[model samples]
Target: MSLRGKRLFSVNCTLGLACLTLCCSVSPLFGQESSTSSSGRWLAPDALVTIAPAMEPGETFQGPVDLPLVLNNPDIAWDPHYAPKSDTLAEMGRDVVFRGEVYCLEFSFKPVRMIAVDIPSFTGVQRKNVWYLLYRVRYLGGDLRPQVEPDAFGNQVFATPQSVAAETISTPKRFFPVFRLQVKGIDREYPDEILPAAKRAIAARERVGQPLYDTVEIMKQSLPVTTAAGGHSLWGVATWVDVDPRTDFFAVLVQGLTNAQQLKMQGEQIEYLQKTLVLHFSRPGDTMDEMQDRIRYGIPALEDPQRQQYILDQFGVEKRLDHLWTYR
Candidate 1:
């Protein structure tokens, strides 16, 4: 890869970590359908993210509030606003972790005083196929009721299920097979990437005299103020199943302008492209054994030579992954 490609990859890697990195706890992000209860989950659990309101803003921030992330899904507009709390994570989001997919996240947001909506129901739910889960979480929200309830933590456990499922890809006929190569179960440490990634993503674009608009910047600001006391992250690699199995999957940069800012490029220029958001959280350069698990960077190591070599050079690759993390 070229120099710019390397820099971009680093930024992508760091930001991916920032997006889903949360405090330590049980795999609240893990749950599956069994021979049990009520309805279907409108939103796939695999793609859910939880954020707590920042009661007190941090040093670099001013009144950061919690709001559902809005992606450009012509199918779904806004997600049901989800207010998260440290205790309620158990109920907020959990995935029926197949194979070894894992996620963690935290936000330095003060609780916003907004009207409360009752959490949606998945009382008795069934798991959707892989493709369905990918599409809904990747590009849609805001139709069905949310999956939520108060867990023992006194925190409201919830899932943002839309009131009505958008017809966009409602049926399988409308769905086309998306190529995916997911290689899970690997871990490593690259404390060096944090600061540089934040600065690089910020310098790329400054908004209103502030660069917080960038994802990495958002992470930089959020990490300190937010804490998942018992959180951990995972790392692994794979090219999309159909894509170059040799070349591993990489990061998601908004390409042109961030996808949300695409409104200005409407008409012929409006290309509603989709970028996957992977979240992982970990502290940089910390050596506390109390911290057993750590944030797993979502960047999957591809079997391709370029990708494996790039990761090896950029972040120290773990020995366990050395088997696939080899040259082409």
Candidate 2:
């Protein structure tokens, strides 16, 4: 064989090895990008797909439409006829109730992310750190509604004795979510704030091309019913600023995803509770150095088991819970 032929063969072998090494390194990154990309990414709704029932039938106090009173003169005597009913009567006359069955939208979200942006404040425009959550809501038909049936007397009565029955309600539903970011232990709450700059930055960073609505704009969006072809899901972003950097444990409380509510009796007062979605998160490492990527979605039991109980206590759950729907 010629001397130049052997040299040429050696050069070709070296080039092939280099090409293979380059592909090996780039392949992992390419795969990661594909997985994280919007088209390929999806978090299942899981438990959030079910319906949330109302605590009790909503009640309206039956009283005189007009009250007998004299603003300027204090000589007006209280009339028994115009007096309001007693608490016992109010409970007994709860015949008029609303929202027998509350339909909750199916919700799924990505890990909460953080970004810094210049926001306008009372003093002046300042650079602020913002945390935002990207989420999608889908409407799946078949929610329980109050059902009625004919009794032995041939009279239409509620199938269940309690007036609550298994039923399905078909109608258009809207989402008006209220996001509250609460720091565990300290119990400091930070309500969601709309930061246009932070939202734009997040959209570009996350490569989200869909129209991401804020809390207000999301109210107008009507979630379409899911079908075999595809399930129509609406994407939105909830943002919060001025989060305490020293915070290690926090949870995002999402309300308005469902109209399910319960009437609570506390002494002489009545309290109304709404079904809310709580997303638990933990941030580990030194508090001085705050990094968005360090914030994790679920409990970090493996990393720090000591802090797990403290975080779970805040949500009133004994065990590890990443997300849950409860009356708040």
lDDT of 2 by residue, 204-311 (tens): 777543678888888998766654444466778999987888777889999987777666655434567877888888877554646534778876665566665666
- State residue 199's C-alpha deviation in candidate 1, in Å: 37
Q: What are the RMSDs of all candidates, in order?
A: 28.4, 9.4
TM-scores for the candidates: 0.17, 0.67
Regions of candidate 1 where Cα sits further than 4 Å from its true position = 1-162, 165-263, 266-268, 279-295, 298-328
Worst 10 residues of 1 by lDDT: 128-137
| lDDT score, candidate 2, position 197 | 74
Residue-level lDDT tens digits of model 1 in 270-304: 23233222222111223233123232334344688
Q: Name the candidate that leads on TM-score.
A: 2
